[model samples]
Target chain A: AQTVTQSQPEMSVQEAETVTLSCTYDTSENNYYLFWYKQPPSRQMILVIRQEAYKQQNATENRFSVNFQKAAKSFSLKISDSQLGDTAMYFCAFMRRLNSGGSNYKLTFGKGTLLTVNP
Target chain B: DAGVTQSPTHLIKTRGQQVTLRCSPISGHKSVSWYQQVLGQGPQFIFQYYEKEERGRGNFPDRFSARQFPNYSSELNVNALLLGDSALYLCASSMRTGGYTFGSGTRLTVV
Candidate 1:
């Protein structure tokens, strides 16, 4: 079983500044996937970024990026030029790499970190 | 093009009562998964159905059951509801593994 952990319960960042949300996981599987999801006040969860455990290069999507340290099991998300829209509850998730033709795509998520991007 | 759709945005039930939550997967998606999210906590996996078959189940009790229809639409049924069951129930759909689109979720309050 894989477990994700977010040490910061709440984080605050000013608009146009940068902020990083920390995450770590414990997994025995060598190949897997990590994801960061944001749930705003509307209660809709939106995918922010993803990182593959086997890949050394971190994933970057627009203003969202990740620092994935496979050895340390750390996958932190960084938001550059943070905007008010980025204020939300951020959750870090993990999924094991099942064999091809398997459909067990369940995700294990962390408690979450509430991020407040102040204007 | 419609993402995952869950009906009954909010529901209230009494203890020992039963409730059913519905979900319509995105067109062309054959796999659907259910999750339970409590306040101040992350979502917990409940069940996963693919092609109208049960593919996986999480640590939830047997009182929590679910099924997928031929159209890939799914229904989650919870019996003997307790106050602890009050939470947001989320449904996610995907064509395959690694990618998932989630619904806004149905808030279930058990009194």
Candidate 2:
């Protein structure tokens, strides 16, 4: 079993500024994947970014990037030049890599952090 | 292409009643997964299906059941609903190795 934790319940950032959301996880598996998802008022879960455990190089998607510290089990998301559209509930999730006989790709998620971008 | 589509955007049911939710995966996707998101919380995995077979199940009780069709569409049925079942149910579709694309979700409220 794996567990993901988001210590910050809420965060606020001014538009065009930068914000970082923290995430930590407990997993014994050596290979897996980490993800950040955002859910707006429309209630749709949208993928923000992803990181592969075997890759030392972090992942970056435009204004979104990740600081992944594999040894410490820490994966944090950095949103630069934040906009009002970034205001939403952000969740951190973990997924184990598919091995022999692994039939499904299940995501274990954290409680979430509510991010508000102030104008 | 159309994304994952779930039917009945919102539904309200009485306690102990039964409800069935539907999902239509993307045109080429062969896998479908279901999740439940409670208010103020992240979504929890409920079930996953691939090729019309059950691939994985979460910690939910047997009262929660689901099936996949030949077309890769899916249905989640919950019997003996409880007030705690009031939540948003999301459906996602993907290739075996790709990232998941989620639907807008169906809001189920058990009274």
Candidate 3:
């Protein structure tokens, strides 16, 4: 089994600034995927960004980027030019690589970090 | 195109009662998965269906069951619901390989 950990339970950042949320995982599998999801007050889980373990290059989507250290099992999310819309509960998730005939797409998530982007 | 849609945005049930939640995947999507999110916590995987077959299951008990239809839609049924079952239930759809698109989720409050 796999476990994802988000050490920071809560974090606050001023608008237009940058914030980084930490995440770590324990997995023996060599190939896998890491993800960051945001849930707002509406209770909808939205995908932020994703990283593939096989790739050394981290993933970037606009203002959202990831610093993935595969050897140390660390995957952190950095939000630049933060806005009030970024205030939400962020979760780190992990999924194993797909096999030939089995399903391994189920995501294992961390407790979550509530981010408050103050104006 | 429409994303994943889940029915009964919110509901209240009594203890030991039964509840069924519905989900409709996006067009052409053949995979649907369910998750439970408790207050102040992240979502937990419950079940996954592909091609109208059970593909994966989480550590939930047998009281939690689900099935998929030919159209790739799915239903999750929970029997003898307990207070702990009160939470947000999310449904997601995906292709064979890619990130999942999640629904707004059904809030089940077991009183």
Candidate 4:
């Protein structure tokens, strides 16, 4: 079983500043994918960024980026130019491609970290 | 295209009563997943259905059951609801090739 761990329960960042949220996972399989999701008070999970285990380069979308260290089993998300709208609960997730074709892939998620962007 | 859609934005039911939640996947999606998010906690997977068949189930008890229809719509039913079951129930839709797109979620309050 794969388990994602987010050590920080809460994080605070000033407006326009940068913040990094840490995430680590345990998985025996070498081929997998990592994702960062954001859920605001609305309770909707939104994909922030994704990293393919085979890719050496990190993934970035707008202000959101990921620092993926496959050897260390670490995948951290960095939010540059943080804004108030970015304040939300962030979760790290893991997904392993199944060997069997035509199968639905499952995701394992971390507890989450509450991020507050202070003005 | 429209994203994942879930009905009964909020529901309130007493303990021991049954509650049903509905979800409709995105236009082209074939997989739908259910998750529970308690206050101050992360969303936990409850069930996953693809092509109208059960694929994955979580650690939740059998009291929590869900089924997907041929149209890629799904429903989650909880029997003998407990106060612990009060939380936001989210439905996400995705394809085998990508990540899930989630709905706003239905808030279930078991009083």
Candidate 5:
């Protein structure tokens, strides 16, 4: 079983500043996918960013980027120019690559980090 | 376009009772998955259905069961509910091997 760990329980960043949330996971599979999800007060899970283990280049989406270190089993999300709307509970999730004839899409998530972007 | 839709936004039930939650997947999406999000914790996978068939199930007990309809809509039923079952139930839909679009979730409260 794979387990994701988010060491920081809560994080706060001032508006227009940058903040990074750390996440690590335990998985023996070399081929996998990692994702960061944001859950707002409305309780809707939104996809923030994703990274493929086979790709060394980090994934970037607008103001969100991930530092994926496969060897270290660490995948971190960096939020730049943060806004108040960015405040939410951030979760790190892991999913193994789809095997032949397999439709496994289950995501194992971390405990989540409550992030507040103060203005 | 409307995202995933979950019905009965919120419900309250007592122990030993039964409850059913409903979800409708986005158009053209063939896979629907269910998750339970306890307060202060991330969502946990409960079940996954694709093409009206059960594809995978999580560690939840037999008390938790779900089925998908021909139109890709899904229903999750809990028989003999417990207080610990109180949580936000989320529904996600996706094309095969694609990213998921999640619904706002139905809040289930068991007293």
Candidate 6:
């Protein structure tokens, strides 16, 4: 079974500053997918970034990016030039490969990091 | 143009009562998945349906069920609801390979 773990329970950042939330996972597969999701008080789960396990290069989107370390099983999200609207709970997730050993197209999610952006 | 949408933004039900949540996927999307998000936690997958067939299911009890309609919409049903069952029921749609677009979710509160 694949499991995701986010060590930070809460994180705070100042407007225009940066914040990095740490996440780690345990999986036996080599080729898989990792994701970061944002949930605001509005209760919407929005995708932030995704990383392919096989890709040695990390993924970046506008101001959001990931630092994926395959060997260490670490996938941390970095929000640069953070805006107030970016304040939300961030969840780290892991999806196992279909043919590897299981069939749960399901994403194993961590307990999430509650991020609050201060103005 | 449209994204995933869910109904009954908020609902309150007592323990042992049945609850149903609805979701409409993005147009032309063939896959719909359901997740349960409890307070202070990330969403947990409950079920996934494709082409009106059950393709995958999460670690949930038999009381939890879901189905996808011909139009690609879906519904999640929970029987004998318990207080622990109170959560935000989220619906997500995917095209292929499980990169999902999620809805705002239906907040279900079991008393």
| lDDT, candidate 6, A1-119, per-residue tens | 88899999998999999999999999888788999999888888899999988788999999999999999999999999999999889999898643333333677899999999999
Q: Candidate 4: lDDT of A26?
A: 99
- Tens digits of per-residue lDDT, candidate 5, A1-119, equal 89999999999999999999999999999878899999999999999998988899999999999999999999999999999999999999998643347665788899999999998
Residue range A7-39, candidate 4, lDDT tens digits: 999999999999999999999998788999999
Residue lDDT tens for model 2, B7-98: 99999999999999999999988889999999998889999998898888999999999999999999999999999999999999987754
Q: What's the number of clashes in each of the models?
A: 0, 0, 0, 0, 0, 0
Off by over 4 Å in 2: A97-99
DockQ measured for candidate 1: 0.69
Better of 1 and 3 by DockQ: 1
For all predictions in the order shown, the interface RMSD in Å is 1.8, 2.0, 2.0, 1.8, 1.8, 2.6
Model 5: CA > 4 A from native: A97-100
Cα deviation in Å at residue B76, candidate 3? 0.1
The digit string of per-residue lDDT tens for model 1 on B1-81 reads: 788999899999999999999999999999999999999999999998988888888999999999999999999999999
lDDT of 6 by residue, B62-84 (tens): 99999889999999999999999
Candidate 3 residues A1-119, lDDT tens each?
Answer: 89999999999999999999999999999988899999999888899999989999999999999999999999999999999999999999998643456544888899999999999
At residue A43, candidate 5 shows an lDDT of 92
Docking class of 5: medium
Give lDDT tens digits, candidate 5, residues B24-72: 9999998999999999999999998988988888999999999999899
**Where is model 4 chain A poorest over a 10-residue stretch in terms of lDDT?**
A96-105
**TM-score of the first chain of model 3:** 0.95
- The segments of candidate 3 whose C-alpha lies over 4 angstroms from its true place after superposition are A97-104
For candidate 1 chain A, which ten residues in a row score worst on lDDT?
A96-105
Evaluated on chain B only, what is the TM-score of candidate 6?
Answer: 0.97
DockQ winner among the candidates? Answer: 1
DockQ of each: 0.69, 0.64, 0.65, 0.68, 0.67, 0.58
| Ten contiguous residues minimizing lDDT sum, candidate 3 chain A | A96-105
Which stretches of candidate 6 lie above 4 Å from their native place?
Answer: A97-104
lDDT of 4 by residue, B1-111 (tens): 888999999999999999999999999899898999888877888898988988888899999999998889999999999999999999999876568899999999999
